[model samples]
Structures are given as C-alpha cells and as structure tokens.
Target: MTSRPAAPVPATAPAVPAAGRLAAGEQPVLPLSGELELRPWRLDDADAGALLAAGQDPDISHWNLFTVGSRAEARDRIARMHRRRTAGTGAVWAVAPRGGAAIGLAALNDVDPADGSAEVAYWVLPAARGGGIAVLAARRLGRWALDELGLRRLTLRHSTANPASCRVAEKAGYTYEGSLRDALAHADGRHDVHLHTLVAG
Candidate 1:
C-alpha cells in the first residue's frame, strides 16, 4: 500500500487562569485609618440606607449614574455586590467609621484576573465630602488590590467636568494619563473623561 501524509493538528489558545485570589476567600475589611475602614457591604437597613443616600445625592447620581428607588432595591444591589465578589468580577466596600454606618463606597469594578487589571470607583456622602475620605479609601483599596490581590494595573476614569474627582485620583497616587473624548455619559450629556492609572511596582 502507498504511504499517506499525516494531517496537522489545529492550534488552540492557552486557557486563562481563574481569579482564585478574589474568589478563594471571603472579602476582607481594609482599614483606612483609626476611625475609618473599607468593609464589605451588608444586607441590613443601615447599609441599604447608605446606598439610598448615595443614589439620592445629586452629585453621586450625576457622576456615577446610579440610583436605588427604595430600600428593597438598595438591598438587592448590595446582594449583587456580594455576588460579584464571589464571582470574581468585582469587589466593593463600604467606607465607614469603625462600628458605624457606611458613609461612602469604594470599588474595584471589571476585575479581570486574566488581564490582572481593574477599575476604581468611589463616592462619599455630602457630610463626608471635603474630608479626604474618598482619597484615603481609594488609596487603601488600591494598595490591597495591587499588593494582596496581585492585580498588575488599576485605572480610574472620571468626567473632566468633575475636578474634585480628578483631585481624588491624583492624591490617591494615580498618574494622570490623558483625556478620552466623549468617553463617559452623565446626566447632563456625554463628556470627556480623564484617565488615570496605577501600576504595581
């Protein structure tokens, strides 16, 4: 019999590693200072109220484009936050004084273990504004994400119209990269966004 040529094997992409660091254990409580900490959100009335307050705040709603109509909705959102942590897609924390109610939020959204990256977001209540809480919470959370979680890069994007947020990003050790034209849509309209980044050393 005549010899036949062998067929070539098809190529395949390498498999991505799962986000074991984020999903392997319970979310941790990160302390910002003696009085403040970034802890996991609870499904209780007080935490729900914090979400409600953030939704009702004109600045937070306008910038973050988030709103909860009622306590039930807020609780649902809180539950989703917990679910995301377990799913390794996100990690969110409530910024609170020790043994007190949440007064703000800090989050690492769009967590991608394969890419080793995430985006940072945060907002503080009106009463907590102007006290550098946002900056502190952001810095603390960024440290944990980079050092503990082993993420290589973190990005922060904010509307150019919001200078306060820009300040927060700067003070939190993020380097200003550049602006993206019409990158974000706010309540007013589509706006340019400033991109800031922090890379693990």
Candidate 2:
C-alpha cells in the first residue's frame, strides 16, 4: 500500500507539555479534521457517557479491551483513563463529530520517551462504521505523534478477522508487519492478531 507523507507539524502549538503529557483541558496540540474532529479526551467527557456506551455496541467493542469484561468494567476503565491522563501516563482521545456525540475513541496507549515510540488504538461506533472515519483518525493521530510528540515510530494492532481495521491501518500508512498467533485469547478462545507499524521519515 502507498503511504501518505506525514502532515507537517504546526509551529504554533507546543508539542507536549514540559511534564511530558499533553496539557489537560486545553485545545489539541495539532488540530485535526475529516470524518470527525479528533481531539484529546477530556475528563469532563466521562459525564457524557459515550465512552462507556461504546462498549455496549457489539460491533464496535468486539475484540476491544472495553468489551473484554462488562459494561461496568468499561465505565471503570474510562475513569481510569482520566486518572492516568492526570498522572502523565498517556492520552485517550474522543472521536467526536462537530455538534454530535462522540462516536469513538483513539488513544496513545503506550509510550517510550527514550525511544520515541508509541502504540495507537482506536474504536468506532457501530453507527459510524463504513465512513472511512477510522483511517482518517489514524492518519491524524500519526501526524500528531510524528510532528507534535516527535515520535520515531508508531504501531497499531488488530485481529486478523478484522479486515476493516487492517484496511484502516494500511490507508493510514502503517506497514503490515505480521501476525502473532494466539496473541489474544477472547472469552471463547485465542485468536491471531495482525501487527502494523509506521516509522517516521
């Protein structure tokens, strides 16, 4: 698959806060658009209930951590994300449409500052499927990671059965690195997971 050049980082916005984590309750470090306006997750969004609700949609939550357990567990996880953000661990962004409710979430799940590498994860509402939103979101997040965070590499993983997800990663410029058999065991059984990676030029 062909890769699009990473978007140029804007000079106006500071990459990350001095402490490492993006500043809480401020505008996105790199404003993004298309399909939806991807922005940083706000602690205030917990009250909106979409984060937890995303877990309830089977099509959206299948193979996702939020749906691994139960609805209450998903709610707790969202709360935990907020706490972690304040603790300077990482960020979970809400994929919200302008003047609409949040339909999904994308996050910088892991980060290694010394190596400048991070893993990106995201999900979309069942209602929002088939819109090319996931690919657009992933690309926007990649731009932020490369230009804003100055990351050297970013990776995304999905189950082999999830062809839509694979397409999203490919469209966003991630190379299909390979698959890991029995990588994740669902409640039913283990399944293979496809791993993809993108390195900054």
Candidate 3:
C-alpha cells in the first residue's frame, strides 16, 4: 500500500451524527469500519474543504459533472450534503484513511428505500489517485449500504471515457451492467456512460 501524507484533521474531534438518526424511527446509522471510518460530515472539516478545492483543478473539472467553481460554492455543496442527509435522500462520506488526511469523498445518493437501491459516486484527490483509495472507499460504502442500511443493490455510472472510474468499480467487485449511449448530457453535449452494479443478499 502506498503511504499517504498526514492529514490535518484533529484525531479527537467529536463524531458527527449520522443522517439516518436525524429522523425519528429510522434505522440508526452505524459506523462502517475502523479501517475506514464512515462518520458524519463535520461543519469544521477543514480537510474536506481542502479536498474539494483540490478537486477544482482543471483536470478534475474536465470530467466532474458538479464543479465547485468557487470557495462559496464549495461551502454551499458541503452544506447541501448535510441537508440531504437530514432530508433522508443522501449521505456523503469523507474518505479518510487511518492517520491520513481526507483524500476524497464517496456518496450514496438518489436513495430509494422503497426500491432498496441507490446510486454510488466517488472521487479521489489528485494527490491520492493511483493508490487504490477509491477501491477501498467504494468497498466500504457498498458493505455499509448492504449491511447497515439494508440496501439490496448499489449502482454506479461513469462516462465511458473514464476508464479509471470503471476500474475502480471493477476493483470493488461491481458487475458491468453495460453502457447507455448518448444518455448523459454534459456541458460539451451528450456522452455515453458505463453502468455497473453490486447486489447483496
């Protein structure tokens, strides 16, 4: 495993409350792992903010659908992630490696409890790329969705042009479900996306 640079987060900060726990009668959100803690989003997560900023690099923005164009937008997106969790529609995880700074984010968004499924998306900072952080993070996210959230399946999609993302899905054991041609609309126009799925018992 590639050693990562030390992150700036305080080791003793209070654990953030899980989004599922925000509403009454919902299943309590459990921490997914100590190997890669799946704690709630902290308002004071300076490292997360830094990760978002790092993601705004031109290369990162080239493929990212949702771009944080400014510091204000970055703050707003973080706030919105918190709001979505409270609203019960989504949850975002800071991909923090043990004793390392937060390198990226993985999220279970577009959740549908009635269907027992959700869309999973993830990204790693430039500095954290090629270290298999995305694979580790996606595996943890899939496990938590299945074991803790009682989800039946998780789906992920990325532009067909992004083979790195496809590799991440495959590395994390998601089955290739085929592609949707001209199904995604981007600033440049329409593009194809490869869909992948992971089903759990």
How much does each candidate deviate from the true structure in C-alpha RMSD?
5.9, 9.5, 15.4
Report the lDDT tens digits of candidate 2 across residue range 8-114.
Answer: 98786323334454434653633446436876555445556676677576756556745524545555776777666666566777788765567778887666665
Tens digit of lDDT per residue, candidate 1, span 1-201? 988888878876333336776977789989887799999988884444888888889999999998987898998898899899888999899999988899999999999988888999999999989989999999999999888888889999999999999999999999999999999989999999999999888
Which portions of model 3 show Cα errors greater than 4 Å?
A: 1-36, 46-48, 98-100
Model 3 scores a C-alpha lDDT of 0.72
- All models: lDDT? 0.90, 0.72, 0.72
Q: In model 2, what are the clashing residue pairs, if there are any?
A: none
Error of 3 at 95 (Å): 0.9
* Better by lDDT, candidate 3 or 1: 1
Residue-level lDDT for 46 in candidate 1: 41
Off by over 4 Å in 2: 1-30, 67-76
Model 1 worst lDDT run, 10 consecutive residues = 12-21
What's the lDDT for residue 37 in model 3? 53
Task: Give the Cα RMSD of candidate 2.
Answer: 9.5
Candidate 1 Cα misplacement greater than 4 A, ranges: 1-17, 45-48
Ten residues in sequence with the least summed lDDT for candidate 2: 13-22
